[model samples]
Target: MIEPMADPKLSHQLDDKTDDIKKAADVVAAHLKKLEQTQKDAKDDIGSAQWRLKESQIYNITKHFRQIMNQYNEECVAHRDRCKKAIKREFEISGIRRTDDEIEDMIENGFPGTFSFS
Candidate 1:
């Protein structure tokens, strides 16, 4: 049988990390929407030199943002993997065997069952 975590704070910390990732995602999404709007606005002035300059600038900015987001995603994945390993180790020490899918669910959704020590 699965048991509650020995320390409840660990669960909160994991949730905080997940929340940070979600916040980053929201920021990226908002920036993309703004970029889309800028592109749409530029379409009306497509023939102007000024519009060309703006379009080039926008392209460069979008490229940079994409690179940064990619790096952030990579870091998040690494962190997640580390968390999974730590969680698996904890379960192993507790003499509980959990499938990878089950562990993932606990990480992604927070611990499902009670978290208090019996």
Candidate 2:
């Protein structure tokens, strides 16, 4: 006696289901790859933002220090002028008749008994 063959309709249905499952798996894999790339891009963007923030902070700090230095220099200049005026007044009161240019030169170049290393 000959053995009976399997049903063709059942085999076709199984093949169709297998193909559907494979297509679904492929879609899932593609989605996962896209998600991974998106994550990497987000990390890179965060790093770039951090660097920009750091640079801005550095620039602001430098600008602040520069302003402080400029203010200090202005105060020093004002003090120096006051000292020069006081010295000129003292000289005049002591019967010393020196010209404006001479007094300025003496103040900048150091007086005879003044301690100057520059």
Candidate 3:
């Protein structure tokens, strides 16, 4: 029954890598927050289109809103992917296993956004 000795160098390297990943994740999370807010605002604008009196005005407003919404959606997806990659990199570096759903939940719930692990 021999116990393995801990490697101090490896521990320090893992800590450094974890810090780097956490920093990257924080950046991505901030972008995700902005994208999420923009997406919500776009949805709100589109939902308010019911006040239009003229059909042409409604069509134009709807079209504009749709375009804005589409752009936000695209940006949101991009930010989400960025966060996903960061999390994946962290997992690889730290050897922490997390499911896709867990990673998504973290971003959605603003877990890594503030870089507040507590």
Q: Which candidate is the best by lDDT?
A: 1
Residue 80 lDDT, candidate 2, scale 0-100: 53
Model 3: CA > 4 A from native: 1-54, 113-118
Question: If both were scored by TM-score, which would come out higher, candidate 2 or candidate 3?
Answer: 2
Error of 3 at 35 (Å): 28
The estimated TM-scores of all candidates read 0.62, 0.49, 0.44
Candidate 1 residue lDDT tens string, 12-97: 76557768877987787688779768777766688789877877877787788778778877876776777677777777777788
RMSD of each: 5.9, 40.2, 15.3
> Where's the lowest-lDDT run of ten residues in candidate 1?
109-118
- TM-score for model 1? 0.62
Of models 1 and 2, which has the larger TM-score? 1
Residue pairs in steric clash, candidate 1? none
| Weakest ten-residue segment in model 2 by summed lDDT | 1-10
Going through the candidates in order, what is the number of backbone clashes in each? 0, 0, 0
User: Poorest 10 consecutive residues of model 3 by lDDT?
Assistant: 1-10
lDDT of 2 by residue, 1-118 (tens): 0111134454345447647855765675566556545545665555687656755665565566557656755764675576566656667667667788876786565443222212
